[model samples]
Target: MSWTDLTATDLVPLPVVLPLLAAGLALVFARRPRVQRVVSVVALAGVLAVGIALLVLTDDRTLVVDVGNWAAPIGIDLVADRLSALMVTVSSFVLLCVLLYSLAQGVSEEAEEETESIPVSIYHPTYLVLAAGVCNAFLAGDLFNLYVGFEILLAASYVLLTLGGTGERIRAGSIYVVVALLSSIVFLIAIALTYAATGTVNLAQLSERLPDVEPGTRLAIQLLLLLAFGIKAAMFPVSAWLPDSYPTAPAPVTAVFAGLLTKVGVYAILRTQTLLFPTDPRIDQGLMWVALLTMLVGILGAVAQDDIKRLLSFTLVSHIGYMLFGIALATQPGTAAAIFYVVHHITVQTALFLVVGLVELRGGSTSLDRLGGLAKLAPGLAILFFIPAMNLAGIPPLSGFLGKVGLVEDGVRTGGFLAYTLVVGSVVTSLLTLYAIVKAWNKAFWQEAPQEIETDARVPRGMVVPTGALVAFGLALTVFAGPLYSYADRAAAALRDGSYVEAVFPDGHDRGVGESNETIPKAGAPAGPASAVDTGEGTP
Candidate 1:
């Protein structure tokens, strides 16, 4: 169908489908680098556009698309509520910027006759696949489909992580792969157990059926899901793999991985926790402690790191605690803040990594001992790095500061010792984050030269422009924080009010759509046909 002819239900799958189709076309045109770049950019641009449309459309209702026109609890469905729509929009925007950044890097490398760490022939297609996977996970309406989404991204990531085939890259990728596989296995078992208990893996159905399952079995299923998603999110003890695995990849790969991947885990956790077990105080309390430890441990590691990449990696882990803290409160205000924080972090973190790439390009290394004098040499780059760094540190008037304030207020309102402790921990983590970022700033930009700078290695405009655009986008978040947070609040309310479940099963039965199978002629009628209606606008 033409773009104008497509309805909201038709739009649900495009975010996932467009990228996969583009990836195939990109692979076919692999021999033509320019064609690959054009295809990748256009595809992601289309996703971004679709995501924006969904974001606006989903503000008032949730949209669901059954893959084969079969109803939920049997056929797969893709969902786009405010939460998933917001995620898809922000992620697609980040993916597009990162693609632009990588394209510029490729051009610069070609000019220098340097051997590329990321080959364009493979990079474009693989990156598109990764994008598709991320969109899939966000949009998936069932547990098994979410698993499929996770696997697609993980498979693509292994290729991107080890693009150079260098010993360091391969070693890091191996560590990453092993951890990912273990998580996947745990997730698979959780799905099996959930199905065994409830007879379906569809999330809306699970929400209805889980409470009726035996309490012990239900709790076990919840914990298994948590363990699996926690590892993927790099929560506390499970987070050890992240800092080691991310910093070894090409800058663009590392940037996307650091920015988007863990957030997917966080998204899954938020969705399941709110939708599947809204009343489970046990897991929520445990999550509070996990949030506290994740914050303190992650920031402590960041404080000790001298490598810019590793330091940021640690900070990435540290800040995840804040999102988890908001989630653990199990309150609408808290969940809203968490959603807002996730958006702020994705933009700010991705921009920081892109700036670090530029720093590495100019300084010849990410290690503090080997880098210095950059502020004097490249003032624009210094500004680019400084903005996102401060934003990440939760400096006042920034979106980060706003998100944290909302979380803290919600925690105090919750009024418990653990909640109070987390409130304190959040403050401490932000301060430490500032300290760590400042130390990197001082060593990399302010300190006297520890080694000769790469004066000949120009920071190409191709790279710098996209990096600047992302930095500008981060600034935009601060300016537009009000409406965004309101949207998040609405999303949180919907999660709590059973609106999503209602949307998925509008008839109060197995059939998600309004029409009935009995309406058709038994012999000649197709078993399932795509639902023509919009599943009705969701109640917020």
Candidate 2:
């Protein structure tokens, strides 16, 4: 179909499909670096356009598409709501910029030496696959599809993480693969139990049936899902893999992984928490404690790190607690803030890692003891790093500060000893975050050189421009916070209300254009103000 002839439902899968198609074309053109670059860029740019269009289209409505036009509870489906739309848009922007940054890195490395450490033939296809996986996760409408998305990305990441085959990269990749496989196994078990209980793996269907399920069985399923998502989201105790695993990859790989991957996990938790089990306060309450501990532990680790990438990785985990803090509230304002925070973080964190890449290039190392006088050497780079660093530290008038304030206000309104304590923990984490960032700043940019730093290698303009564009995008969030926050509020309302469910099964029954012999059992809607089910009816 022509673009002009397509409906909103038709736009639902392009973000996932475009990348996979481009990945195949990229593989065919792998022998020609320029052709591969063009294909990758054009494909991601198309995805970015589609993502923005979907975001605008889904502003006031949720769109669902059953793959191959087959009915749900049997065939796979994709859903585009405000939450998923916003995630796709932001993640596409990040993915596009990181791709450009990596391309520039490759061109510059080739110019600098005879041997290229980054293999272009392997990089383009894998990166596009990574993009497809991320888009798939954001748009997935069921548990098994979500698991499929995770595996796609994990498989791509293994290749990216071990790109160089060096000892450190190999070791880090091994650790990462083991942890990811374990999480996948746990998630698979959770899906099995969910299907056995509800008779379908469709998320909208589960929202109706899960309430009638035995409370103990429901809780077990909820906790298992949380355990799996928590490991992926890198929540405290389970977050140990992130700091070590991320810092070993190429700077661009690390940037995208740190920026988009964990947030995908957080998005899963937010979707399932608010939609599938909003009535259950037991898990929400436990999430509050986990959020607090993750904040404290992650920031403490950040403060101790001298390597810039590892430091940023720890801070990445630390700031995730803020998103969790908002999710744990299970209120409209809290979720809106969490959604807003997710946007802020994806841009800011990715920009910071790209900047660190520049630092490594200019200074020959990422360690504080090995680097100094960067401000004098690269003033533009200094400005680039400083802006995002301060924003990350939550300085006034930045998106980070605004997002944190929203979370704190809601926490105070939540009004329990734990809520108040989380409020306090949020403040302390921000302050400690400032301390860690400032320490990195002083040591790397302002402190006297520990030795004579190499000044011959020029920081690539190709790399700097993309990095700067991302930094500017983060700043734009601060400028646009009012409208964006309002959008998030509406999105949160849709999640809290039954609008998402209503949109999926418009007549209160299983829906699609194709036939399914399988039947969805009818069940009464759960009794609660928080439940998002509108009808107890099921498809027959």
Instruction: Please tell me which predicted candidate would have the highest lDDT against the true structure.
Output: 1
Question: Number of clashing residue pairs in every model?
Answer: 0, 0
Q: What TM-score should be assigned to candidate 1?
A: 0.94
State the local distance difference test value for candidate 2: 0.87
Residue pairs with clashing backbones, model 2: none
lDDT tens per residue, model 2, 391-505: 9999999999999999999999989988999999999999999999999999999988899987798988889999999999999999999999998888888887786776556
Q: Write the per-residue lDDT of candidate 1 for residues 390-425, one digit (tens) a residue.
A: 999999999999999999999999999999999999
Tell me the TM-score of each prediction against the true structure: 0.94, 0.93
Model 1: pairs clashing at backbone N, Cα or C within 3 Å = none
Candidate 2, which segments miss by more than 4 Å at Cα? 1-6, 107-119, 510-540
